[model samples]
Target: MKTILELSMKSVTLAVVLTAGAALAGCSEINGVMNDLQTMTTSNLPEQGIAQPTNKNAVSLKTDLVGLVGWFENSCGFDPVFYTEGTKENQVQKRFDTFQESFMAKQYKTDGSYTAYVKPDYRSKLPANYREAVKNISVVEDSTGVHYYVDFNNATYRGYDLSRLELFYQPESDYVYDTLYFKNANFVDLKSVFKTTRDDLDELRGGEFDAKSRSVMCYLGL
Candidate 1:
C-alpha cells in the first residue's frame, strides 16, 4: 500500500509539471505575436503606401473625389474597400465622397466642352470601349463633365480599375465606371507600378485648386 501511494503521487506531480510547461509555452508564443504587431508603421512603407491627406482640417469636394480615384487606381492593395456589393445609399454616398477628394485637375484636363470616357475595369493602357456620351451625364460648361461607366461583368481581377461612377463594386448589374479617375491614370508594369523613384507617381498631387474624385480611371500614359 505504501509503495502504491508513492507511485501515484509521483505521477500526479509529473502531470502538474507538464501542464505548467504548456502554459508557459503558450504565453511565450502570444508575447511574440504582440511584439510583431506593434512594429507596423507608415514610416517603413513607400510614398504611395503613405496615407498623408492633403488637408487635415476639412473635407472638400475635389480632394474627396481624387482620393477615391487614387485609392482605386494607385493604392489598391492598401484600401480596405476591396469588397463592396450592398447598394445602401450610405455606401453610395461614401464612394461619392471618396471620389470627390483624390483626383486632381492637372492630370485631368477639361474644357468648356466636355466628353465622358468610361471604363468598367482597368485593363491596360486603354479601355475596351471609350463611349463619349451618356444621357443626363453631368456636363458643366465651367466644370468639365464627369463620365460614368459600369463594370458589372468583371470586378474581381487585378489590373482592373474596379470603380464605377454611379455604382459601387457590384458582382453583377449595370455599373458605372468614371473618367474622373481614369483621365489621370499613369500606366506601368506590375514591377514598376509601386517602385520608388524621383519621378514616381506620388508627385501627381497638387494644391492648385483642381477637381478630384474616387473613380478608377484607365491610364493616359504619362
Candidate 2:
C-alpha cells in the first residue's frame, strides 16, 4: 500500500512540475515581447516588414505640385501632366476663414497676355475628338479676355479617360472634390494629403488656405 501511495504522489508531483514550467515559459515569452516594443518606442524604429512614407516636404511650388499631380494622375503611381497653376476663378479649391488649398497657376500660363497656344504637355494634351471648346468650359481670364480652357478629359489611361475632377472648399469644413455639374466626387482628402507630402512651398504656392491640420504623428512615430 505504501509503495502504491508513493507512486501516486510521484505522479502528482510530476504534473505540478510540468504546469509550473509552462507558466514560467509563458511569462518569459510575454516579457520578451514587451521589451521589444519598448525598444521600438524609444528608438523610433519601424516594426519589421512594415512600409514607411518616404515623401518629404517639397522645396518649391513646382516640386510640390509635381508630387501632388504625380499622385493624382494615376492613382499615385506616375506623374500626371494635367494640372496647371490654379486661378481665382475656376480651379477647384478649398477656402477657409484663414486658409485655403488648391493648385497654383500652371507653369505654362501666367498673369500676362497670351500670344499663342502654349506647347502642350502630357497633362494638357487631348485628342481632337475630345478637344474642349471655350463656350463649354470654365477658365481663368484677365481683363483683356485672354483665357485657356482646360480639357478635363486630358488625363487618360488604357484608352479610358478619367472623369472630370474638381475641388471646392467650405470655410466651415474640409476641402472636397466635385464635378463641374455639382455632383459630389470622392477623392483624396487634402488634409491628409498635405501631411504626407509635407511641402515647404505650400505656404507661398499662392492659392487659398485651409484650416484643418491633419495628424501625421503616426507616420512620424510621434
Candidate 3:
C-alpha cells in the first residue's frame, strides 16, 4: 500500500506532465497560425504586384507578364530587349546596338519627342491597383497557339477602353519563338505601331532595322 505522501506526490507529477503537454500543444497551434498569416501577407504584398491565379496555365504566365510589365514601367518604355522574345545573340540586340551608335553620333536627331511622348502618358494609363487589377488571367489554348488574356479591370486610356490584353505564345523547345502582342486600349494593335516605327527608322538611318529598337520607338511614338 502507498503512503498518503507518495500518492500525493504521484498525483502532482502526473498533473505537471499533463500541463506541460497542453502548453506545448498550444504553442504549436499558435506557431502554425502565425506561419500561415505570414505566407498570406507575403503573397499579397504590393511590391510583388501580382495575385495568385486559379488557372494552372496562368501560374507561369502571370510571372512572365508581371516581369514584362515591371520592366516596361522601370524603363519607361525605353528598354525593349527585355520584353522582346529572343536570344541575345539574335539580330534584335545587334540592330538596337546600331541604332544606339547612330543616335550617339547625332545621325538621328530627336527634339525630346520620344521622352515627352512616353514619360507621362504611358505611365498614367497603367492600372493604379496593380495587384488586384491583374489578379484574374484567362488562358485559351487552340490550334493557333496558347493565348493568355489579362484584363486591366479599371485601366483605360483616352476615349479607348482597355478591355483585354492578350499575350500569344507558341511553345517551341522551351523558348518564346514569336513576337509578343499587346492590344492597347482595345483599339490599337501595338504590333502595327512597332512595324511603322521600324519603317520610319529604316528610312531615316538606311540600315538594317532592329525589331527590339522599333518596339521601344513605338512606345516613345518616335
Q: Give the best candidate by TM-score.
A: 3
Model 2 alpha-carbon miss at residue 171, Å:
30
- Per-residue alpha-carbon lDDT of model 2 for 63-156, expressed as tens digits? 1122122233222211122233463211221121111121223343475533323243322332222233111333343443333333342232
For candidate 2, the per-residue lDDT at 97 reads 11
Where model 1 places Cα greater than 4 Å from the true spot, the runs are: 1-23, 39-49, 53-222
lDDT preference between candidates 1 and 2, better one = 1
**Cα lDDT, model 2, residue 176:** 30
lDDT of 1: 0.31
In model 2, which runs have C-alpha deviations exceeding 4 angstroms?
Answer: 1-68, 71-114, 118-140, 144-146, 154-185, 188-190, 195-222
Tell me the tens digit of each residue's lDDT in model 3 across 167-219. Answer: 44444423221122233424333323222212334432111223432322112
TM-score (C-alpha) between model 2 and the true structure:
0.21
For candidate 3, which ten residues in a row score worst on lDDT? 113-122
> Candidate 3 at residue 126, lDDT?
37
Please provide, for model 1 over 1-222, each residue's C-alpha lDDT reduced to its tens digit, 9 standing for 90 to 100: 001111245764565566566786666665664465344332233233222333423221111223233333433322233234463433543554443332212123464432333333223322212221111222222232233333322121133332334422221233323333223333222223332212244434211111345333432222
Q: Which of 2 and 3 is ahead in lDDT?
A: 3
TM-score of each: 0.19, 0.21, 0.27
RMSD after CA superposition, every candidate? 20.8, 21.9, 20.5
